[model samples]
Target: MQENKNEKPFIPTLGITIGDMNGIGPEVIIKSVMNPKIFDLVNLVVYGHGKVLSHYKNLLGVDKFSFNQTNNAGQIRYNRLNVINCVEDIEVNPGEETKEAGALALAAIQKATEDLKEGKIDAIVTAPINKNNIQSDDFKFPGHTEYFTEAFGAHESLMFLCGERIRIGVATGHISIAQIKDRLNADVIRKKLELMLKSLKKDFNIGKPKIAVLGLNPHAGEDGLLGNEEIEIIQPVINEFKEKGELVFGPYPADGFFGNSSQSKFDGILAMYHDQGLIPFKTLAFEEGVNFTAGLSAVRTSPDHGTAYNIAGKGIANEQSMRSAIYMAKDVLLARRENTH
Candidate 1:
């Protein structure tokens, strides 16, 4: 963790967690940090198996970059990507799942977040982890978002996405469509909206961002013809939030809200559920999209794309999303800093 004293200092210790070893996390991390510009702006602290990083570096053929363990965050070069390896002596096989890799991924995130909570790192950006593997019979958990929320005792965290076009925040995420009916409540909607507004200002650099919200049912409940969630659950929240001086609007129908031409009007959109937000989000921006967890004490982000396992070792995985994730993480860190003082 020791940083180089002679070189210009990086703002925050950007701790990176190599996600599921079986997936594309390691490749993206290896490729993303190779750019000299990345190392110049942030102090990199990576969590994951050292051997896995070695394999990735060898694959990327970065001969000059080396690994060193540090006790203090003062000796590492800001120009050279610094890794505080959290795990060691683990075998890495692409496209193959194992409990050890999954275990290591969680360990890295835990270590990184613990440092962030303790003020060792200013922010954390995670690589993607395979949810299915983590939910195995032996392991009991839903996913990283839920796991981290529980680990930190965070109350009802919000999952939001960042894109080149319109940014999106979700009210209810990572839940089944069937379960969304019971999940939609005025209190939850208001809190998520409040978090979204705060994130727009603090994370996305939006000054008085106007957020367009989507209705729960098709055609925005069609004036009670289709459903009542809009009038009962949604409108109340939106009205109250507007009264609170938040720049928020809608109960806009999900169908007609998207078009290449219509995308530029809104700074952010708040969707009631996952698919409603992600369908338009992935459609509008996929390869370059970044996943950001809003409403956490620590900043966390990841590439919007999933672990493209089929293309793991082919040397063809696109680094755009990972690159975008790092950039967004830095922006959020700066925004958070500006808000504090």
Candidate 2:
């Protein structure tokens, strides 16, 4: 049920998938939820094995924390971390990639996704999973964005890397840099812009969002001296939006656009490819960034960083990104609710 605007705020039941138990997924998750204040925001439910979490809880030496162990979401107790067992007696080998860990990750994802579909949970905050290990017959997508996009039957989705100061959406994702030119076209760029526009309005409450589009080549193709893509492909689309009276601009040179911090002038940014946007975003806010999949029918968010295999079980993994993801999921869900009402 939607919360009434005049009523007290409703606490959302947020689901978390313990991604790749061997990595720092479990550790960061535990640390994020350890604070009692989180319970005041939402009902937290984790989809993973109790035994694996117990191992990490002991490894991290968290003695004063407690949680409810169950296979049912309906039995989740408020004010305590609740874990729904998705796998049975899984072994955890930190800093190592194994088929067992992959299976556990997939199981939790499948279970939480099912719950989300059935309205058993409001939204999901996923921890980092090793993309290489989490491949199987049931899961063949490139990453979580693609997986959830397909699962929810969205024609396309945007890999929106969001931080406090800026938000960026990629025109193409999880593809080779060589293939960007071949895959990128007017239709692709237009779709991404549409998704960004709608998400900024509905998910973020930006009624008239100003967006900046980044060029694919050096110096934004230097007026066609560097590349023709900016002239032939990108600018035409930007002009199309402008002709329609939309607040979209650029084919700005990727280097100078971000290098000069021009991102602050717009509400959202559209980068031509992955590394072009992420390298700068991570550099700016790696610890607090949230990777949100926009345009999906349901709300899903994950930490901007991946599984830190080198730091797995080291007791030093930063939980701020994980915490931010959980909070972002709740915020987006609330935004969606408010827009609907």
lDDT of each: 0.78, 0.93
lDDT of candidate 2 over 139-185, digit per residue (tens): 99899999999999999999999999989999999999999999999
Off by over 4 Å in 2: 1-6
| Model 2, CA-based lDDT | 0.93
How many residue pairs of model 1 clash at the backbone?
12
Per-residue C-alpha lDDT of model 1 across residues 1-341, encoded as one tens digit per residue: 46568965337767787888778888887777766677667777777766776887777676765655554344555556566666656888887777777777777777887787787777777888877665554346666667667666778678888888778888888889899999889998888888888888887778898888888998999988999999998998899978978777888888887743455687878899999899988987888998888888778888887767788766677888888888888888888866776
Can you give the TM-score per candidate against the true fold? Answer: 0.90, 0.97
Among residues 3 or more apart in sequence or in different chains, the pairs in candidate 2 whose N, CA or C atoms overlap within 3 Å are: none
Question: CA shift at 7, candidate 1, in angstroms?
Answer: 14
Residue 193: error of model 1 in Å?
0.5
TM-score of 2: 0.97
Error of 1 at 108 (Å): 1.0
